[model samples]
Target: MTFSLLARCPETGRFGMVISSSSPAVAARCAHARAGVGVAASQNITDPALGPALLDALARGRSAPEAMAEVTAIAPHIQYRQLLCVDAAGRTAHWSGERILGTWGVAEGDGAVAGGNLLAHDGVPAAMVAGFAAARGDLGDRLVAALRAGRDAGGEAGPVHSAGLLMVDAASWPVASLRCDWLDQGCPIEAVARAWDVYAPQMAAYVQRAMDPREAPSYGVPGDE
Candidate 1:
């Protein structure tokens, strides 16, 4: 029911995830990341706690595989869960349990991993990783490219209704958290991309405004008098 990517940007040391699904608000449950740590995605009968648990393990100096092991060991209903994790060192690991939905699989690339369940085909995850690897520009752009690739390469077996992009830089707060909760006339992935296009240029300005309003650029809108 879902396809997702978790990634770390070597240039900026940021971690992020992009996700889409036939289910509404998939990313809120499936995509997870922590600054200076790593990323973990839990889907296919997702246990939302597993994402944070994996991050906690990574923060405690565990490798990706080790974290997955520890998390799955104690997590309830393990046989129904699918999890993928990438540590700060770029090590990756994943598990697709015995009872996950149709055509589920996973793939990895440099500093990234992709996974999917109830896919149109098993190739979706690999296509996402390849897309992330081949795309240019910042991490967000690459992630969105990967998402588009998954969509183009036959996404979910059913219509995809929701999508999200999440990223965190050095700061405690997220740098990007865009979601398309519902789509009536357009693709959710494309909607998220459009939101990013509007948000990207202003991100720095918004940050600057919070840090030092005097040094921040103008809002570029009217009525500042």
Candidate 2:
């Protein structure tokens, strides 16, 4: 059971993803991207190897659908796999294997794609895409908003054990790699959303400080000389 989203913000050009499933470290195995290439989410039946190579193909100017087709073609028995891909240029493509039961995925908006398997209904995917399209602001905000929408639309098939948020930019370090493992009760999507809210400002400041050391405000927090 899972409901996840991947997107790029129109305002910031920043790319990110939100994933929650019974799976462990859903972020690392299921999500992949290159700063100047594209972002992809392969789940339900993930193939950890495909993420990197697909992004490499995109970096070389492969369109979203082309790269996805090529990847799946390499392994025609991609049943149980639900994949979504969005290129650096904002193009999108998605595929849900026929044998992937309860899987519903969507690729929509300016630069966003939402997908899931073992979900409550097909509406989940469409809802995710619509939610992202309706979202405003930076990448963080859009990602959180998309997750919220997915939950409201009946996320997963039952309960949620964990949730993760990932963002990568063009640099040595990733833009964000934050997540919540094994949250309490039915849905952890909301809790993960709150985490991002608390973390964004601080991280943004930290990033600002790194970008311009002079802007690191010298707060008078006692002995903070």
Q: Which ranges in model 2 have alpha carbons more than 4 Å from their true place?
A: 184-186, 208-223
Off by over 4 Å in 1: none
Q: Candidate 2 has which clashing residue pairs, if any? A: 102-118
Judged by TM-score, which candidate is best? 1
lDDT of 1: 0.91
**TM-score (all chains, Cα) for each model:** 0.96, 0.88
- Per-residue alpha-carbon lDDT of candidate 2 for residues 39-71, written as tens digits (9 for 90 to 100): 888787787777776777788789998988888
RMSD of each: 1.2, 2.4
Candidate 1 Cα deviation (angstroms), residue 163: 0.2
**Overall lDDT per candidate, in order of appearance:** 0.91, 0.76
- Model 2 Cα displacement at 189 (Å)? 1.3
